[model samples]
Target chain A: MDPVTLLTIVVLAVFVGFEVVSKVTSTLHTPLMSGANAIHGIILIGAIIVAGQASDVWILAVALLAVVLATANLVGGFVVTDRMLHMFRARKPPADTNTDAGTGTGTGTGTKGGAQ
Target chain B: MSLLPAEWTALLYLAVAVCFILALKGLSSPKTARRGNLVGSAGALVAVITVFLSVKLDNIPAILIAIIVGAGIAAPIARRVQMTQMPQLVALFNGVGGGAAALVAVLELGHTDDPWVRVAVVFTMLVGAVSFSGSAVTVAKLQELITTRPLLFPGMRWVMSATLVAAIVACGFIVATGSAGWAIALLVLGLAAGLLLVLPVGGADVPIVISLLNAFTGLAVAASGIVLGNVLLVVAGTLVGASGTILTRAMASAMGRGVSGILFGAFRGGSTAGSTTQSDRPVRSTGPEDVAVLLGYAQRVVIVPGYGLAVAQGQHTVAELATALEERGIQVDFAIHPVAGRMPGHMNVLLAEANVPYESLKEMAEVNPEFKNTDVALVVGANDVVNPAAKTSPGSPIYGMPILEVGDAGQVVFLKRSMRPGFAGIENELLFDPKTTLLFGDAKDSLTKVLGAVKAL
Candidate 1:
C-alpha cells in the first residue's frame, strides 16, 4: 500500500475509534475494553500468513505458536465479553430479539423471583 | 503471491475492515453491544477466509491444528472465569496478543529489506514485547502472585533509561545491518523495560497500566500491519490504540490521578504511599441487626459497592438485600463509582451477574445528588469510593477524585472486614463520623446476617 493510502486509513480510524467509544457510559467501560481487546485478536490473519509462507521448519514453529496465541486472544476475548454483556440482559425477553432496549425499562419491573 | 486478483483481495479486505468499525460502533450502546461483537467476529472470520482463499498456503493442517488448540484452551476458561478475576484474565489475554504480534513482526524481519519496513518491524517488536511483559506483570499483581504495592528500588530510573537507550541503539543496528542478533538484543531490552514500567505502579493504578499496555499492543499490531502492507491490520490496530488511550485517560481521572502521575508517581513515593496503619481513633461499630433496622426504617436507600464486595463473594447477598429493601417500598439505588472494581465499571458487571437490574445501578455522577434525600446509605466492602476525604481533605491521595457522597445521607452503615483502608490505603473520615455505624465482619457474612435481620423486621 502507498504511504498516502495507509496514512489516510490510519487517520480516519483514529477519529472513528475515538468517536465511537467517547460517549460510552462508565458502566460499559469494562465490556467495551474487553470487546476491543478481542477485536485485535484478528491478528490471527498475520500469524496465518507467516505460517503459510514459512521458509523452514524453525520459522514454521514460531509462526504456528503465533497462530495459537492469536487465536486464544481473539476467541477468548469475544467469549468473555459476551458473557459480561449477557449479565446486562433484558429483564424480560420472550424470545424477543429486537426493539427492546432493556437498559432503560429494567427498573421497577422485575418480580422478586424474575430477576434471579 | 495470491491466487485472487489484487483488486478483489483489496475489496474483500475493505469489507472486513468495515465490519470492525460497525462492531465498535455497536459497543457504544448497551442494546447493540452484543450484536456489535458478533459482527466483529464475523469480520474476523471473513478476513481469515479471505487470506486462505486469496493466498495459496502450505502447512494447512498445522495452522488449523494451532487454531483449534488455542480455541480449545481459551473457550472453557473464558466461559467459566469468575467475575472477580476478570481483570487478570483480560490482562493475560492482552499479553498473549502482544506476544503474537511480536512474533509475527519477528518473522517479517527476514522477508523485508526496506529500511522503513525494518523500522516498522522494530517498532512492532519493541512495543509488542513491552506490552506482553507489562501485561504479565499486571496479571501477577492483580492475582496476588506478588505484592500489589508499588515496588521501587535504588537507581531503578537510571536502569529504565539505560534500557531504552540500548533498545534504540539496537533498533539502529537492525535497521542498518539487518542482523537477527540486534533483534534479539532489542527483544530482551523491551521485556526488561516492560517489567520496570509496571513494577512501580500500585494496585489502585493497575487497571490504568493494563489499559495503557492494551494501547501499546494496538500500536504494535498497527506497526506489524505496516510491515505486511495489510490495510485491515492497520485500521483495526489504530482503532484499538486510540480507544484504549481514551479509556485509560477516563479511568485515571475517575481515580483522581493523571496518566503520567500514576506511571511515574513512585519516583516521588506517591504510588508507594499506601498507608497500612490502623487508626487508633474510636469508631462506633455495630452489628447486622442495627444495620437491618437502619435499612428497614429508611424511606430511601443507596448501596455503595466496592471491590471488597466482590472479594468476599457478597454480590448475590447484597443484591437480595436490595431486593428485600425494595419490597418494603423503599427506593433502592446502587451508587457505583467509576473505578469501584478491580477495573473501572467492573462492579456493575459483577452486580449484573447477580441478576441485579441495570437501571438500579447508578453511576457516580447520576447518584451523587440523590444521597442527600437518601435515608440510609449502605457501604458494602467499599471504603475509598465512599470516603469523604476524596472531597474534603486536600492532602489525601484520593482528593479531587469524585466520591459517592454517602456522607450526605441521613445515616451511613458500613459492612467492613476491618479498619484496613481501601486500595489507596487512605483512611475514610466518614467511618468516624457520628452518623456512620460500622459492621465489622466479612462482607458476605455480614450481608447474610443483615439479610436475615432485614427479613425479620
Candidate 2:
C-alpha cells in the first residue's frame, strides 16, 4: 500500500471510469448513475474488515453500524437500478399488458433474469 | 477458515473491479444496460462471499444481523419507489454509502500513525460527511418535505466559507498531530458544508447537486481505500468518483447550466429570481371539445410533457391520448426536453411505465425542428420547457438551455391547472401567445376528457 501505488491505481481507475460512460444516451443516465452508485457499495468490504477486527466495544459498535449502512447501500442500489432497467428494456411487440403493476409489485432484478 | 490466501483474495478483488468497468460500459447503450447491471450484481455477490470466506474475525453473528437489517430496509423501498421519484431514491442510496464510508474512516483514525494515511482518513471522513448531508437535503427537496425553492438566509455565504476554512484547518491539525478530536471536528464541519452547499441551490438544479455529491461519495470511498490499504476499495471508489464527475458535467451542459453557476448561484443572488406570482394576463381559455376539434383536424402534432404530468398521475391517460391520436392517422410525437420531468431521461422512464412506445418518444434536438411542420403542439401539464422565454430572455434562470420550439407549430393547446409558473419559478411567455389555448384542470382528468373527445370525433 505505497502511496505511489495507490495514486497509480486511482489515476488508471479514473480513466477507465470516464472512458466507460463517455457515450451513454440520456435515457440511461439515471440507471447508469444508480449503477455507479451501487458499485461503490463495494466499500462494504472495507466495512466488514473494520467491523470484524475492532477490539474496543465503542469501535465495534460504530463499525457494525457502517456494515449495516454499506449493506443497504449496496443491495438497494442494485435492486432499484435493476428495476429501472427492466422498464427501459421495454421495446418490443409489447410484453405484459400490466408490466407496470407487474414490475411495481414484483420489482425484481431477478425478474429480468428469470422471466427472460 | 480462510479459503483464499492473501494474494488470492487480492486477485479476486481485482477481478471484481473489472466487472464494475464492464457494468458501466454495458449501461452506455439501451440494449446492453440491464445485462450490464446483472454482471455488476454478480460481481458484488462474489465479492461478499469471498470476504466472508477469506476473513475470519469477531462478532460474526452481529455482522450477519446488521447486513440483513440493512437489506430489509433498502430492498422494499428501492423496489417500491415510483419511477418519477427515482432520482431522489438514488440520492438517498448514495447518501447512505457516503455515511458508511465516513464511519469506516472514523474507526480507522487512531490505527494509522503515518501522516499520509491520516491525511486519507481525514479526507474520507470530511468528503463522506458532506456527501451524506448534501444528498439528504436533495432527497428532502425532491420529496417536498421542505420547500423546493432555494432557502437562502442572511450571511449564508460567510457561514459556508468559515466552515470550509475551519474544516481545512482541522484536517491539517489531524495530519500534524494525529488527534481524534481534530478528526471529529473535521467531520462535523464537513456535514455543515454539505448542508450549506445544497440548501441555496433552487429546485431546478437539485439533480446536478445530487450528481456532484455522488462523485464526492466516490472520492471519499476511494480515500477510505487508502486508509485501509485495500486496492479494490481504491479502484472501485475512484471509478465512481471520476465517472460521476464527468456525468455531472454532461448533465449540466445538457441543462445549459455551467457547473459553477449551479453550485454558487445563490451567492450571486440576482441570477435566481423566480416568481410565484400569478399572471392575470389574458390567455385564450377553451374546453376539452374544442381541443379535440383542434387535435381532431391536425395532421401532425407534437406533445410536450412536464413534471406536472407526473404529479397528476396522468401518464396513462396521456399515453392513451397519444394512442387515440395515432389511430386517426395523425403524426404524433412526444418531444422530451433533456431535463424533462425532474431528471434527464426521467420522462422516458415515466412514459415507458405507461406503455408509450419507445420509437415515438423523441429527444429535444431530434424533435425541435419537426415542430415547425407540426399542425398542433399539444402541451400537457407542461409549461417552462416549451416557454419561449428560454430563447428570448437573457435575464431568465433557464435562459441558455435549449428548448423544444413548440411555438413554431400552427396551433398550441395548453392543459394546465392554473396560470402559475413552472419549477424554475418563471412565467412562461408562450402561454400568452395568441396561438395558445389553455384547458384548465387536473392533468389526468383533462387528458381523460381530451382522450374521450378525440375518440368521439
Candidate 3:
C-alpha cells in the first residue's frame, strides 16, 4: 500500500504489458484491444469498494451506477473478444467446409508480410 | 464470514495478474489466441469473485439488481452484434468503462479528505469523463448515427485548448477548496472537452482515437485504484494503459501519420482540391459478364477487399467466388492492407468468418510481389489501399503509406457501387489506369452475378 511499492508495481506492469503486446499480430489486433479493455474492468473492484462503504445516499447512488457500468464493460468486453477469437480457428473442420480453407501461417510469415 | 484472509486475497490477485499476462502472450499467435482469451476471462472471474468475498455490503438487493440489469443489457448485444459492427461495439463498451471510472472517482471525492487522495480523485474524474464522452462520439461516428467527416471550423483548436485549460483550473480549485460545485463543473467541462476533441477528427482517424481513448480510460482506472489503495487495480489498469498506447502509435504509423498530426490535422477541407484533377479523368467501365469471363480463364486471381466489402457484408460472396474460381483450376489469394478496414485486421476477421484460409490471406508485402505474376486482380469495395497516390503523389494525404500493388497485375477488375472517394477522400488514380476496368454495383450483388456467370461458363 506504500507509494513506492505501488510505483514499482506500476512500472513493472508497464514493461510487461509492452513486452507481451508488442508480439501480437495485426490480425489479432481487435481482440487484443478488447481483451485489454476487459482487464481495466478491474475498476469494478474499486466500484464495489466504494458502493459497500458508502456513507451517504447520494454517494451510494453514484457508486451503484459505477458498479453497473463497470460490470457491463467487464462482461461485454470478454464475451465479445471470445466471439471474435472463436472465429479464428487454426484449421476449419471439414464438416464446416464452407468456412474452413487454410492453415494459420506462423509469426515469421507475418513479420515478413508486415515488413512491406 | 470472510472467504479468504487479506494475504490470501492479495495472492489470488497476483495469480490473476499472471493469467492476464499469459492471456496476452497467447494472443501473439492465432493457434493460441482463443485460449488466451479464456485465460483472461478466468482472471476476471477470480478478481470479481475475490472482491465479492471480501466486501461486506449494505443494500445487497440494490447491488444485485444493478448487476442483473447491467448483464442483461451487455450480454445480448455482445452475442448478436455482426462482425461489421464490432468496432462500434468495442467503443460503446469502452465508454461505459470510462463512465464507471468517473463515477467511482465522484464517490471517492465525498469520502476522502486527504489532499493526495483528493488529487487522485480529481484526476480520475477528469480523465474518465473525457474518455467516456470521446468514446461515445467515436461509437456514433462508426454507427453512422453522426456524420463521419471532420466537423471543424476556424479557431476550433483554440476552442478545444481553452476548454482543457478551464477543466484543469476547475480540478485545481476542487482539490484546494474541496468544493463539490467545482468538482461537478470540472466533470461537465471534461465531458465537453472530450466531445470537442473527437468532433474534428474524420472517420479514417476514429480507430486511432478509440485506441487513444482506451488508454485514457486505463489511466483513469489506475488513478481510481490509487484513490482506493488497491494494488491489483493499479497493476491491471497500468498494463492496459501501456498496451493501448503502443497500439495507438502502431496504427498511426501504419497510416504514415504521427499521433500529433492525426490529432490536429483537420483533413476535410484541405484535400478536396487535390482530388479534383483525377475525378475528371475518364475510366473504362465493364459489365459483370465480362468480369466473370476475365476471371474465369485467369491463371491467377488476387482479391483485394476493403471497408466497403465489410460494409456490404460481402465476405461470403467473395469467398464463394474464390472457391468457384479454384474449382476451375485458378489460383486465388487475397491481399490485405494493414490499415484496410475501420479497425486493424478488420478484413481478416470478416474473411475468416466466411471460412477463408488464414494462409491464403496475404499481407501487403507478401501479396504485392505476387500481383506482378497475377493474371487478374479483383478489387472488392476497396479503393485507398490500391490507389497509386499512396506511392506517387507527394501532395496526397496517403502518399507515404504502403499499399497493395494490385495495379501490377495483368488485368484489374474493380467492383464498386460508385466513383465515390474512399475514407481518405482521395481519388484513386488506379481507376483511370488503362489496365483497369470498373464494374459498378453493390459488392455482394456484383460478386454474386460474377459467381453465376462463372458457374454458367
Candidate 4:
C-alpha cells in the first residue's frame, strides 16, 4: 500500500498495456475500445465501497447514483462488445441446389432459387 | 476492519490485475477476442465481489437496488442498439464511468483526512467531471442530436485557456486548504473545460476525441485508487490510460494530423476554404446500368467503403452485389481504411454482419497495390479515403494521409448521392478524373439496380 509501490505498479502496467495494445490490428479496434471501456468499469468497486460506507442521507444518495452509473457502464460495455463481436462471423456456406435438395427445407429452397 | 486478511485481499487483487492484462492480450487477435472479453469480465466480477467482502456496509439494500436498476437500463440498450450506433453507445457508457468516478471521489473527500489522499481526491474529481461532460458532447455529436461540425467562435481559444487555468488554480486551492467549496468549484470548471475541449472538434475527429476522453477517465480512476490506496485500481486504470493514449495517437497520425491540430487547427476554417474551387471542376457521371455493364465485364474489381456506406445501410446490398459479380467470374475484394467508419473497424463490422468473407477484406497497404491491376475500382459511398487529393493537393485538408489508389485502376466507378464532399468537407479530385465515373444515387438503391442490371447481362 506504499505510495512508491503503487506508483511502480502503475508505471509497469503502462508499459505492459502499450505493448499488448500496439499489436492490435485496425479491424479489431472497435472491440479493443469496447473491451477497455469495460475494464475501466472496475470503477464500480469504488462506487460499491463508497455507497456502503455512506452515513449522511445526501452523501448516501450521491453514492447510490454513482453505483448505478458504474454498474450500467460495466454491464452495458461488455454486453455491447459481445454483440459486436458476434457479427464478425466466418462466411456462411455457399448456396448450392444439391445441398438444398438434401436438406429439403422450403425456406432454404426459396432463398437459393431467389438468388439465381 | 476487513473481512479477509490484508495479505489475502492483496493476493486476490493481483490475480484480478493479471486477468485484466491477459484480457487485453486476448483482444489483440480476432481469434481470441471473445475469450479475452470474458477474462476481463471475470476480473471485474472478482474485484466487485472482493469489495463487498472487504467493505463494512450500512446500506446493502440500497446498493443492491442501485445495481439492479443500473443493469436494467444498461442491458437493454446494449442488446437493442444497432451496430451503426455503437460509437455513440460507447461514448454514453464512457460518460457514465466518468460520472461514477467523479462521484466516488466526491464521497471519499469526507472519509479521508490525509493531505495526499485529499490531493488525489481533487485530481480524481477534476478529471472525472471533465471526462463526463466531454463524453456527453461527443455522444450528442455522434447521435446527430447536434451538428457534428466544429463549433468555433472568435476568442474561443482564449476562453478555453482561461477556463483551464481557473480549474487548475481551484484544484491547487483545494489541495492547499482542504476546502470542500474549492473542490466543488474545481469540478464545475473542469466540466466546462471538457465541453469547450470537445465542442470545436469536427465529426471526423470524434473517434480520437472519444479515445482521449477514455484515457482521461482512466487517469481519474487511478487517482481515485490512490485516494483509496487500492493497488488494483491504480494498475488497471493506468493500463487503460496508456492503451487509450496510444490509440488516440495512432488514429491521429493515421489521419495525418497531430492531436493539437485536431483540437484547435480546424477551428480556423482553413480546411474548408479551397473546397469551393475544387467543386467547380467538371465531373464525369454514369448511370447504374452503365456501371453494371462496366463491372460485369471487368476481370478484377475492388470496393472501397467509408462512413457513407454505414449512413446508407448499404453493407448487405453491397455484399450481395459483390457476390453477383463474383458469380460472373470477376474477382472482388474490399479495401478498408483504418479510419473508414465512424469508429475504427466500423466498416468491417457492418460488412461482416452481411456475411462478407473476412479473407476478401483487405487493409489499405495490402490492397492499394492491387488497384493498379484492378479492371474496375468500385467506390461505394466512400470519398475521402479514395481521394487522390490526399496525395496530390497540398491545400487539401486530407492531404498527406495515405489513401486507396483507386485512380490507378483502368476504370473507377463512384457511387455517391451527389457531388457533395466527404466528412472532412474537402472535395475529392479523384471524382473528376477522366478514368472515374460517378454513379449517383442512394448506395443501396444504386447497388440493387446495378445487381439487377448485371443479372440481365
Q: Say which candidate scores most in DockQ.
A: 1
B169: Cα error in model 2, Å: 0.7
Model 1 Cα shift for residue B315 (angstroms): 1.4
Q: For candidate 4, write residues B162-217 as lDDT tens digits.
A: 99889889877777777778878988998898899999888878888999999888
* Candidate 2 chain B least-lDDT 10 residues: B351-360
DockQ of 1: 0.60
Runs off by more than 4 Å, candidate 2? A90-116
Candidate 2 - CAPRI tier? medium
Ranking by lDDT: 1, 2, 3, 4
Clashing pairs in 2: none
Over the stretch B1-457, how does candidate 1's per-residue lDDT look in tens digits?
5388878888988998888888878866666778888888888888988988887799999999999999999989999999999999899999999999999999999998899999999999999999999999999999999988888889999999999999999999999988998998998999999999999888888998998998898899888999999888998899999999999998998888899988888887643565689999999998889899999989999999999999998888898999899899988999999988899889989988887867788988899998889999999989888887778877666777788888999999998999988887788888899999999999999998999999999
Q: Please provide, for model 2 over B224-261, each residue's C-alpha lDDT reduced to its tens digit, 9 standing for 90 to 100.
A: 99998888889999999998999899989887889999
Query: How many residue pairs clash per model?
Result: 0, 0, 2, 0
Model 4 per-residue lDDT at B79: 94
- State fnat for each of the candidate structures: 0.70, 0.80, 0.76, 0.80
Interface RMSD of each: 1.9, 3.2, 4.4, 2.8
- The i-RMS of candidate 1 is 1.9
Q: List the residue pairs that clash in candidate 3.
A: A99-B355, A102-B357
